[model samples]
Target: MTSRYLDYSGNMDGELRMPGKDKHFQNTEDRTDSGLDSLKDEDYNRIVSGVQNLCIPVSATPQDYEPEPWKVQNNEDGDTLLHLAVIHEAKDLAEEAIRRSYRDGYYLNRQNNLYQTPLHLAIITEQAEIAEKLLQAGCDPEIRDYRGNTALHIACQRGSLRGVGVIVQYSKFQLPSLLTCYNYDGHTCLHLASNNGYLAIVEHLISLGADINAQEPCNGRTALHMAVDKQNPDLMYLLLKHGADVNKVTYQGYSPCQLTWGRENSQIQQHLLSVTEKSLQYLPESEDEDSSDSESEHSDDEYMYDDCKLMCQGLN
Candidate 1:
């Protein structure tokens, strides 16, 4: 009845050794005389039950297991699966993620490290259909990127007419507010479209009820003023045709016509002049008592503002 135990030392040889001793014993016991024979039947059954309880059954299908919540988010840029899908142009995967998130909707609006939601990336990447799907899935069109430009603003800036149309249509009750929402540079969708000379996008925004006369907060320049500054006669004409106030003046007291003074686009200048009030047609006199104010305004770059400089460069 001498007891022996399986050797668990560094050796691979399957020799039995007594506890507290270095000598090896031959494993000559009959199978029935092994360690299991020493345990009571109930003890053996209990050990078996414990092992069975600790075992986890393998899932029959991948769908049967849910992943950890953190796995859904990309570690690098905090982009979720939906964001990555849109970024890589994996439309089917994006659609699937969107479908699964329909009930939660929170993930639909989740922004990545750049504060850009999947919808923003969709429009920026020119995936109009995916943008629409995101909008339809309750993605908030109002969510802005780090630049404070909403998806709609990006759409207009990038001259994506379909992007603009889809965002406006899906915005439903929020369409009017969204059209007028300003980015960090104080440029609305209309201003971006107008500044970029996106005549079609400007027309589309105006048709959708964007405030044609909405003044950018930076210098109080309206879409009309921007069109004049860009010297885009077609855009100017479109703005005027859509009721853009030609008399609208910048914070510097220069009307759209005044902004046209040194520009070479005679057509825009003449059209603005024809419509602008006579008093606003002339630039503010440089020698007037308010000369210092006008001088200070001129010292700053007329078209450049904070992050807007980067945006303009990107658009170009």
Candidate 2:
């Protein structure tokens, strides 16, 4: 597995408010009241107690007692009922907490100890249904965890195309940003998907316009390099078909083809070489309009010689 870039300093304390903040809040309150009206009083009480037990910390001293639920609630780690629900995989509890948050106007995007929101937890835990619920409830998918990974990045890392779809569809404002998002390691969604051999996620990401050739910050290695390095010929072919630049070299000047050397992916090297040879033919004419035919012929010969030399090196 590729190394994960997970780290953070101080805990971030904030939340993303939905658009039309005041109106959304009013609507949420109304919907929550209607939902509560539909439930038996005892059921509602149980849900409230469950949420409180999971989210609110108990008072160690009498002086710590506060009448305000918002003030008194939240564990020492800052995980809300929603966060706990996703972490515990309690779908019913998660849905109830979501309702309560809407009813009470809680911060849906609040970061816990790990700086992950309820939505992030849902996706990370592979609860696609809950993840969808969070998105439909307007949880911000763009919120980064401590590791600077948005829900989209995590979805890709986990190879959850369904989760990715929910994010891509719901995070309208964050879509463009999400497509280009880089985690702490500078790995994009495409990079993660390809590295992990998640063909479905890769296809979805590419269709959504992920930069197929985006390079990692540390190595400048694109998805193609990762695919080649991982000896995934299928992934390599997918990347190539989607317009990944075959000759793109990393900071160390090693192209995907070069990276395949000494690896067990002779097929990948051969495909890259063939593609390179074809691309060379389309190179813009180097000669001026008046330049001699001989000069153009010489340039073509040199290009072919370079191509042959690279092929020989690859074979060796």
Top candidate on lDDT is 1
Query: Tens digit of lDDT per residue, candidate 1, span 1-316?
Result: 1222234343334443455556654332533555877888788778655533443323223454354484366768889888889999999999988887763446677888989999999999999999988888788889888888899899989999999888878888888788877777788898898899888888877888888899876678888887777778888778778887887777767788988876787887787778779998877576355767765767664554545556643553
Q: Please report the candidate that would top TM-score against the real structure.
A: 1
Alpha-carbon deviation at 11 in model 2, angstroms: 40
| Model 2 poorest 10 in a row by lDDT | 5-14
Local distance difference test values of all predictions, in order:
0.77, 0.73
Candidate 2, superposed: residue stretches over 4 Å from native: 1-72, 103-106, 277-316
TM-score of 1: 0.70
Q: Write down the worst ten-residue block by lDDT for model 1.
A: 1-10
Clash pairs, candidate 1, are none
**Tens digit per residue, CA lDDT, model 2, 1-316:** 1222211221122222243442212223445344677777688768655533442222223453233465236788988767777898988988877765552323677889888888888888989888877777767777888777899999999988888988887887888899897777667888989999999999888998899999876558899889987999999999888888888877645677766645686788788877764433222344334347646765775576556445533443
Candidate 2 clashing pairs, residues 3+ apart or interchain: none
The segments of candidate 1 whose C-alpha lies over 4 angstroms from its true place after superposition are 1-72, 287-297, 301-316
